[model samples]
Target: MGLVKIRVEGVSKVFGRDPAGALAKVRSGMDKTRLKDETDHVLGLHDIDLSIRTGEIFVIMGLSGSGKSTLIRHFNRLIEPTGGRILFDGDDILAYDAARLQTFRRRKVAMVFQRFALLPHKTVIENVAYGLTLDGVAKPEAFRRAGEQIALVGLTGFETSYPAQLSGGMQQRVGLARALATDAEVLLMDEAFSALDPLIRHDMQMQLKELQGRLGKTIVFITHDLDEALLLGDHIAILKDGTLRQVGTGSEILAAPADDYVARFVRDVNRGRILLCGAFADAGLIAAADAPVIAADATLESTFAAFAGGAAALAVRDWDGRIAGALTPRRVMEALARI
Candidate 1:
């Protein structure tokens, strides 16, 4: 059966007036509810509907204050919605009591914040073990599992070092390790690499993709960077002013944006690089033997040299070296011209 790991149905959250606080204000003659009616309060998130499939990397991208963080927080009930249903594996999370919510967070979901959030005094191993320790795992076993997690995130030699001793990238690795150590099925990352330098951030993105491929965990990543969204997402949702602009696979969004906002956002994207080479094909229209060959999955960066070699068409081969398609220079120019 196809399963949805997390489903958000018309979820909406508005701040500035808690139910208890509003009642208290009215009891004290503040008329807070009426005052709220007169004010232009911020809506952190409008009615949002989404479904994240199991084992997929779903990305939410938007400018700051566009509700990306608020929407992500709803997945794990970090911020309860003002209206609508959040279902985890088909169970409504809003129905959970405090204790059950804690259980759900500890066992089924884990979040990694942008700040790393590592305990300053704790060694990397202790930091990773903190969650299990809270659940009453034995010290030896917790440390053993923590070490394996540290190694999994590329922190093998730094297990005994304190957070302050590590570089920013290394510290973030510890944060990732802590999330992995929880053994949670769903991971929520809020701008996890935004704090790093470009080089470090690029490396971390690749590392995360590799780690995800091996682990196959369901992940929801939030970011404002278009390139990051393009690089890491299996499916992407673009948000503007607390509303969804578009949701689609990278190629789908690039090939045909849903509206003006999404089109403007990706106007400068190198379509040649982003579009799949296999997509530019006619079934059974393989290239001639004398044509230059490029891997079917090759990025535009890899195919540019072949395109400049004056061949009428280039042979596109899949991993098996069988002719899967052909790429024409005219098609490449056409795709690139869309930007």
Candidate 2:
């Protein structure tokens, strides 16, 4: 496990004219649904507890009205929690006053939204530097830093273009660059790519993965898409009706769903597509004279691609790229047969 970046401890949110009364009802052993039914108050989230790690893409995924969005807001104190505590590095963020919270938001965390919130009047570089500008950074220094981030997101040439003149994908790049420019420890992304076309969304996913490898920034990405969660998340948390359903890696969630709801949600998932080749590799199989080489973490789907013409066995290579084991054809067959 990595160092814990943010810990949400017993966090809950209720939206109503008398939120305290509704919260009291909830704490007095009333159920989430019953509390809502009996009062005008709405339960946005109920007892959400999670430990988000540093330098990993931690995805919060669920369908609409799952309170996925509401939970994330509490991380940055966008919606003050009706109860419980939010700890950032073991300090209660709920205790932060105006000055302290402002500094925390400006320096420690940055957010990216589904709608690319760019200033139409400002050029790409200008918009990218806007956050630093608000912090009293000089124009030349801010733009210099902004230019570097621009290149990082593959927007070096479009720095002079206005947001309206750019394509939706390019406008999103500006948003990403702006977030990166602050060099914040945590990046809160709320449906950052939901508005893009399929191809563009896929490209952005790949781009985020590549960036994470180099920058190593801890990112909390919100999305309602299961496929997107499976692709991008190092670990995932599933939400439904303001309750956290499950939290685990893609494989763990797929192989062992928590309940009927989760099972139904992942029913159509292709097992072979996500299972690593090492999972199916035979430990007893000694290396042959010329067995094909494969990374231990390589997906079984990619393993199949390696044997497009067909193969009897292949050696499993570890992180150092050494042969750790081999995958016999029969063992691979049984696994693929299930799929």
TM of each candidate vs. truth:
0.88, 0.91
* Model 2 regions lying over 4 Å from their true place: 282-293, 306-308, 315-339
lDDT digits (tens) for residues 257-302 of candidate 2: 8999998998777767776777667777776768788888887777
Model 1 compared with the native: what TM-score? 0.88
Prediction RMSDs, each to the true structure: 4.9, 2.3
171: Cα error in model 1, Å: 0.6
User: lDDT of all predictions, in order shown?
Assistant: 0.84, 0.88
TM-score of 2: 0.91
Candidate 2, residue 168: Cα displacement in angstroms equals: 0.6
Candidate 1 — which pairs collide?
none
